[model samples]
Target: MTTIVLGAGAVGTATAWYLRKSGHDVVLIERQPEAAMETSWGNGGIIHASEVEPWSQPGMPTKIIKWLGKENAPLLLRYRAIPHIMRWGIEFARNCTPERFRENAKSNLHLALHSLKSLQEIGAEAGIDYDRATRGVLKIYRSRDSLDSAQRSTDYLAQHGLLYERADPDRCVELEPALKDTKSTLAGALYFARDEVGDSNKFAQGLAAACAARGVQCRFGETIEKIETRSGRVQAVVTSKGRIVADTVVVALGSFTAPMLAKNGIRVPIYPVKGVSITFKRAAWNAAPTMPLIDDSKLFGFVPIGDRIRISGSAEITGYDMTPAPARVAAIIANASFTFPELKRYFDISKSKVWAGLRPVSPTGTPIIGETRIRGLWINAGHGHLGWTLSCGSGRVIADLIDGRDPGIPVPPPQGVVVARAA
Candidate 1:
């Protein structure tokens, strides 16, 4: 059977790669001239399985309300987006309970760990070198309360194969020498020994090339107009150029996944959450962390992607807008300056690249991946901020399903109108 995977971001590219690897004839389509030119192009580029907790955790509502309207706030809800997101917001609110929060975290962690393993396998198979690093992810906390809460979360995840070490201020500097300047300002840090980092854009591009070598049709510069359905099954994908008869379709369009399927009267609870990143050329090193670091107190992090430093963090409920707000970019820089005092000396604002991309977020913080009510149609979307982190595993599972084989790992049920496991 011929399978068509839509969009060429990391998620879609990974899906196509796995489909072809599993002995299926696949056609990869993208609106752009090439792959990874959208959200996957400008991410923080960290594959962080350590950061598996969802945003909709207990007591998060009050934090969101408190941070409203602040430009530098970690979570921003644009007033204009409130009405459009009312239904999703209600679901988000309902999932704030301790039970739901733990369940969602477990679901995300399962796939994230699987994705991490799958990523290494793909890299070995494809010989991809996206400036890979395995120094682990350091999440620093500024307050005792925050550190304690994260410790509790880590303890739960520890039972599920997450290896982490509690680092004091001195130990943190030993882990990442860049923090040597501000050791006194830190309460403590959680160093996740299992997490890794890399440039996601390069991963998508490299994997796409491998897919082409494997005889998967790479059709670029064609936009999807609609999915022609016949008797509750996908018939052909109508694109700008022409139609291709497809036996199956996997919708991996990221934030655009929901709207595209909605045109076919299928409602997936995927919505766009905007995030921004600023990449700077690393000057002959004054103080840049070699390891990936996320500040729990400040809600931002910077990682070394090759010789470049990329600082990214922020959750804005902006609807489908990919414009990089200058203030937001500046705020990211300012937030990093506090953590790394010498970062300003090396960061050249004029030479930096600022980018914004919409993350396809679901209310439960668990990606919706399964076979939908419509036969011959499948979904691998709603990965949220972990799109890069979840891509490889999601793709492998979906492809396994299409091949009528076991996925080897538990997958989250596809939310909304989805009625069956992908198998």
Candidate 2:
């Protein structure tokens, strides 16, 4: 059977690769001229299973309320987007209970750990290098309470084979000497030894190339008009070029997945949460931290890619607005600089790149992956901030389901994901 995969970002490209490997003819479609030109581009580049907790944790409601309208707040909810996101916001808050938060974190951690392994396997087999680094990720806390909370979370995740070590301020500095400047302010840090970092866009492009080499038809620069469905199954995908018939279709269009399926009366409950990242060219390679670092207090992180450093985080509840707000960008840089004090000296802002992409977030923080009520239609979106972290594993699961095999992973379907019974 021929499968048509929509969106050529990390998830879609990985899906196409796995589908072709599963002995199916696949066509990968992207509106951009190349792959990973959307959310997959300019990401934080950290793949840490230790940070798999959902954003809708127990105390998120209070935090959101506190951060409301704060320009430099880690998570900002735009008043203008309230009406548009009223339903999703309510559902998100509903999932903020302790029970739901733990469940969602476990679900996300399973996929994230699997994805890291999948990435390693793909890298070994395909010999694709995206400036991959194995120095692990260090998440620092500014408050003793936060550090203790993280230690508890790490202990819980440790049961699942994710290795983490609680480090004091001095140990953190020893782990990443660049953090020496922040020793006075830091309470402690958690280092996930198994986590990895790499350029997600480069990985997506490399996987797309591998898919093409494996005879997967990659049709880029084509806009998908609609997905025609009848009799409870996908029929054909109508693109700007023409209609292409397929036995199955996978929607991996990130934030656009929900709306696209809605036209066909399918609601996936995916919302577009905007995030910004700023990449600066480093003056000296040794001047920056070699390992990825996340500031737990500020909810931001700094990732080193070759001679550049990318500062990413800060969620804005704006509906589909990709505008790189100057203040938001500055906030990211400012927050990241708290950890790396010499950031301004080493960073060349003139040569920096600022980007904003809509993350397809779900109420539970877990991605909606697997077949829907529509027999031949599948979804692998709503990964939120962890899209790059979970792409390969999610793709593998989608392929396994389509091939009539167990995905061998715990993939609970999202609540209210079922569309009206297919006619």
Candidate 3:
């Protein structure tokens, strides 16, 4: 059976690998010249299971309201995007209750752990080296109250196989000596020992090469014009080059999935939430911390990937715009310095590379993975900011479902997409 995997980002590339491994003829398509060139390109690179809590957690509505129009806010909602995100925002609000937040966290953690295992397998099989750091991530909190609140979430996730330890101010510095030159005194921290970091773009590119070497057809630099169907079944995908008949079509187009599928009258709850990142060369910064740092108070992360450092964070409810906001980038730099002030003395901030990409977020915080209402049409998208963290697992699950096997873990039911009226 020939299966068409759309969009060769991290998730789509992984799906093609698993599908080919399952003995299916797989063709992976991407508009870019290579895989992971978009959202997967410049992420903070932390495959953190500790950060499973959704953005719609308790009291988040008030926070979003207060953050409205603030350029430097952790989560900003541009006034122009309000009209486009109104319906999605309502569903996001609906998932903000305490009970729902915990349940969503549980679901996210399950997929995240499974993804890590799958990623290890991929790394070994593909022989790809992606500057991996195994020291784990340290999340620091400035206030005792915030630390206590985070502890509750971490403690609950611990029951579901998350390994973590509560760290005092001294332990926080002990975990990462680079934190000793802090600008302000830290209240406490939480360290997730199982979390790891790596360059996702490198991994994706290597995996794509592996897939092609294994005889999976990889057609990059091709624009998908439409999905052709007959008798309510996925018949083929019409691309700019030509139509390729397919037995199954998996939509893994990240933030573009909703619009692409909506063209065929299939509506998904996925919304495009923009995020910003800045990468810097670690020139002359010999003492850069090996372990990733997540500042919970400031809502930013400083991750050292190889000889370069990546500072990334922010959830902007903006529609489809991929332009990086300089103000937001500067805000992230300032926030990152709060935990690692030595960056100013050691690294050149003027040479930082700024980037922005859209994260395809679901209201439930769980990726929508399964066969949709359309026969032979599947979905493996809406991984949100966890695209790299959840990529391989989501791909493996899609392959298992297509191959008539259990997905190893319970998956959300099919036909869960919200059908939208045609404009």
Best by TM-score: 1
Which tens-of-lDDT digit does each residue in 208-285 have in candidate 1? 999999999999999999998989988999999999999999999999999999999988888899999999888776
Per-residue CA lDDT of model 3 for 1-423, tens digit only, reads 999999998899999999999999999999999999999998879998988787878898899899998998888998988898787888889899999989888888888998899999999878999998889999998899999988987889899889999999899888888888772578989998889999999999999999999999999999999998888888999999999999999999998999999988988889988999889888888788777989888989889998898989988887899998888877887887767777778656568888999999988777888776678888899988889999999999888888888777756433267221111
Clashes found in each candidate (C-alpha, N, C closer than 3 A): 0, 0, 0
For candidate 1, what is the TM-score? 0.98
Give the backbone clash total of model 3: 0
Score every model by TM-score: 0.98, 0.97, 0.97
Q: After superposition, how far is residue 300 of candidate 2 from its true place, in Å?
A: 1.4
Residue pairs clashing in model 2 are none
On lDDT, the leading prediction is 1
State how far residue 228 of model 3 sits from its true place (Å). 0.6
Assess each prediction's global lDDT (C-alpha) against the native: 0.89, 0.87, 0.87
lDDT of 2: 0.87
Model 1: residues >4 Å from true position, as ranges? none
